[model samples]
Target chain A: MKKAIQYTTLLFTCAFALGACEKSELVDYNQPDMIYVFKDFDSDVKDSASYSFAIKDESLQYDTVFVPVRIMGTAKDFDREVKWAPVDSLTTAVAGTDYEILPAKVPAGAFSANIPVKVLRNTAMKTNEVRLMVEIRQSKDFAPGISDANGSSWYMPGASRRYLVKINDFLTKPNNWDSFLKFFFDTFSQVKYAFIIKVTGRSEFPSGSTGLPYAQFVYYETVCRNALAEYEAANGPLIDEFGNRVTF
Target chain B: MFTSIKYLCGITLAIAMAGCYKDEGNYDYNEINKIAITSDSTDVVVSQQDTLRINVNLSQTMPDASGLTYQWVLYPTGTAQTRRTLSETKNLSAFITEAPGSYVLDYFVTDKKTGVSFQKRFWINVVSAFGEGWMVLEEVNGATDIGLVTKGNKIYRNIYSATNKGAKLPAGANMIQIINYRSDQEIYIFSPNDMIQVNYIDFLKIKRFDEFFFTAPEPKPQGHYLLGGADKILYNNGQVFPVSLMTPPPFFYGLPLIGENPYYMEPYPIYSVLKGKFFYDRISQRFYRAGPYDIELSSCPAYNPALDAFDMNNIGKKMLYAEHNVTDQHIALFKNNNHDSLFIYVLDAGIDNAAIGKYDVTKVPGLLGADHYMMSKTLTYLYYSNGNKVYKLDILAQTSTLLYTFPAGAQVADMKLYLNYDDFEDPDNYRVMGIATNEGDQGKLYYFHIAGTGNFTGNTYREVFSGFGKLSSILFKSRS
Candidate 1:
């Protein structure tokens, strides 16, 4: 009888210990399924968030940069996967050789994620000034906040997911790309380490691989159209270099 | 008995060796009837510029067919089916065209009732158009005539009248084309209802057509006769005929090109500007190109975002006139069907956002485009008219300068570029501009020169003539 009373007291103490341990249960943050990322989601699709980086760090090695991705909605119950991939189909970049992208996912229960993309800031990149453009796409688990940001994406406004990045240390750039990034778009974008599997059948910008020529071609088309529209209203329609009416 | 058998065998052998035959009962004789074809000339030689006609006489038995059909098939020498059926009729007359080779003009008659047919072929040799000069077509007094223009500006006008032994030239000649076929040059005159083939050298009428095709056709055999007509593409296995009568006619191929609109004239108007051939339906706004196989066709409106397409409704036929600049590779000048808008075509290089590969000339330093524009042979400068003033524009520089100022109230009727080619083979040649002014009572041709490096800088014109009637078109006949 004495042993049974002592065992009952011990069981009560164990139950109280278990009840005290149950206070830290998993919390449901009720976060939205659609969380946006990227920095400049508000500009036109052709207008991408641009960034530039010197090929070398202070130690004279290749430079590593991180692209910031922020969550748009509330936090989640469990760790959520934010899928990310390089818009590599249009890129001539190689994952290991030219650049790198690591940890293409948002960690569970994290409010923000940083995509580390590093490039071979070598002499070739500085000389060619080759540009790489990428956009963050929505996956099955997560949807974008804004639609048509960076052309047909659901990234939220001001979350410019399309990054037009380059590795250059030029003292004077022809198309003023550095100024354009600083003034027109954001300047804090990293290289997208997507790879180019195909060497042909791509809609290359009119400028080929040159940094500013493609931009200039697009700008010329737009400005010329605006100028021509007025000419047609007063004189008739504008004629092309071929002497035919422009349909635009 | 052995001796008698031997003798009988010997006799049988002898008879077999002598080709002996025996009659079973009575022999019968059958008479097979046949038809004959006769013509005045069986063997003839016609130049590529000459038309061949033969009046054939059919035997009495040949007319016994229920619906006796006739096919004048033109077959080339050395084994070929008929390239085209020049004329099909039951009448005695047969029309044939020769395309640079020895050909067999097959006169075929078939009886639809009995399915019996007869063929009488005549030999015809066609000379090629090598070493031929230009054949200029002139429209005077609202009548059309052909003029033979040899080297050194030697011109013989009214060759159509001369070819017809002094008959007046046709009244409704729309266009003239000197076609290079059979290695020879032949001239074709297009009218509202006829296509007259005239000898390029002799200026003699070769053949006349009552039913010729205009636009993309269901395929007919024209041999090389339709070289500049519509698409200039024939649907054949590339052979001249004895038209295996089993096949269909050759047809018009190729979709309309940039700046080619079908000029709805009864007879199709096809004009050659250098190596380029243009077929336009003036009323329908359908344009066709004779050259450049890569020209976008098939799926048409020929989507061109570079060109400023005329608004057919608001412009209302004001923006459809098209002019070709031989020096410009892929450009065509289009004035609004009749409106004041001027559009340019970069041929197949269609622009983005524009409908048919064209663009409106922007507001430049001076006038850039007009209802009437002329391009230099160098492909650099363009002359456009705004009212009575003609402005010269440097295409590369995108600047316009006044080139010529006509007399007040005198509308510039026509502008032509005359290239004094040092060598006929070279595409680039030094050229001058000829402007025709219509001052109500009379028309005058003025010659001028503009000096610039690939541009016309000054406009100093000399009056060439004042006696001509309303001058319609000007063509420089170069060597073929």
Candidate 2:
């Protein structure tokens, strides 16, 4: 009986020791640092964006486009360089003539940085659009993350490795002309648009939910009407490129 | 068996350890001071610029009212809620200067010892001192001013100048329009070269012509009208500018309504929520319609000659006056280019076959020479004034009756029927007529109460107010 009691006491001691043992330190998974191009939450484009200089001022010699790059892993305390290059086969714009890719770097303690690309306005862009395809390359600090494969786990496919930009300077009909702007501007013509730009000194007339106030549109209409009348009075009837009499 | 015994022993040891521990901290409890605030009146009505007083009684459990701090707050109950601190005393004796509307008043009593606050809410109705009256637009000494004739037959002359620091309106001010939306009451004074909007409560200047637009158009206001109770439309330089008052102020006019072609629209607009807005395009000599959401004017569908009374697209006459009568039917008066032929067209406010009837009223006495016209809202009669004689014409019976005549050398300046669309249940609405006449620099305003049969109640004017000026228009100001 004495021996049995001693064994029970020993068993209770062992149970108490086992119950007190637990993990007190956190585990580190040590995920590798990765980087990618940041995508706008509101935009549907995965890896591409289109730009036009048609609405820009004629005197604007050069414009810069900033592409945001994000780090998929933890941010660093020191600044890191981001390696990028243009795909040769898919690129139609010459590096030195049509555009210049500026040096890209992620700032210290930042999750994202914008890569600025300086685009030059050339006479050729008025007749034909040029394309520049940029892709992320592996660097000392980061590896190209989020692939363009079909079954990637990333929410946005092809959003990390590649980004394409289409640039042009040719004039085209505004997307909101028929739905909204027609009430103020009766018809759309290249010559009429140019005249409007000259009179209002503004090329961008946005419409839809995020457009300017209706009062601004009315002011523009009145100004354009008066300008057109004065133009016709000074010089005979203003005509469009299509040989049609331009009227507001 | 030994394994089960070992587990039981371990559990017993854990329970014994927990049961042996005891709390060593000391705690004490005491009751907090309770406060009670009471007021006799929870709903009060007062006029604008009048003093509002409220008495309150407060009691606390621990001490008397000496250790209590009080605060009174007032705020408008409209969509644009603004809070104002009225007083920091126990009793409120505040002079209300807020616009005429509904407001909420809150009284708070805080106990200094316990830091507890007790509150009570009260409802207040603020009516304007210049409420529910006729605003007479008159030209005094070649400059525009306004007078008010209250429902009690009291005349307040030059009220605009009195409230606006003696500043007279523009010289050519010809119209007065009152717009009430949500909790806003605005008075617009329009002139040929300028326009001004004033506050309904004090007649203080709110916005001038240049302030009404992003890029101000020419100051040539033909007329101003309301569309569907929420949108205000202004006509200037043969263009229509509409602004929805539901938007926050300072309100700016939207894009003008321009169709596929250039056209000029008459200032008078026939509007109803169901029918949207209709306008007479003088350039085309036709009628146009625009839906509530439409931003441009659209041509009315072609009328069938056999089934329709008249073609909306082919009305080849100049519009003189157009208005909607009591039954919501539209009546328009027009004349040919020669002015020898006069016509009256009746149309439904909103229907497929809009034309109701068309009649030649060229032979109707006093109509061709009339300078001011008013349509009766309760009957099928048209009242017009020429020289000093007022005449009423019955369209269905094709008869004319002389209503009244002013003194010799008196000329009718303006005429209007008392109609308040917002308050249809008011006793004085749609039951009276106001006429203004000028005689050698003296303007006289007369109010006639109409009977059910479209005749004067006593066969004479109920009230007459005379002063110095040349009255041009009279519009009723409502208290909402």
**Residue A89 Cα positional deviation in candidate 2, in Å, after optimal superposition:** 4.2
Q: Which candidate is the best by DockQ?
A: 2
Q: What are the per-residue Cα lDDT tens digits for candidate 1 across A122-170?
A: 5565555655555566766566554344434445334555555555543
Candidate 2: TM-score? 0.74
For model 2, fnat equals 0.15
* lDDT by residue (tens digit), candidate 2, B138-194: 887788888888777767788889988899987888888876666567788988898
Q: TM-score of every model?
A: 0.34, 0.74
Standalone chain B TM-score for every prediction: 0.47, 0.78
lDDT, residue B437, candidate 1 = 66
Tens-digit lDDT track for model 1 on B302-377? 4333443532212223233343344223344445554455555443222221123345655543343354666675
Candidate 1 chain A, run of 10 with poorest lDDT:
A192-201
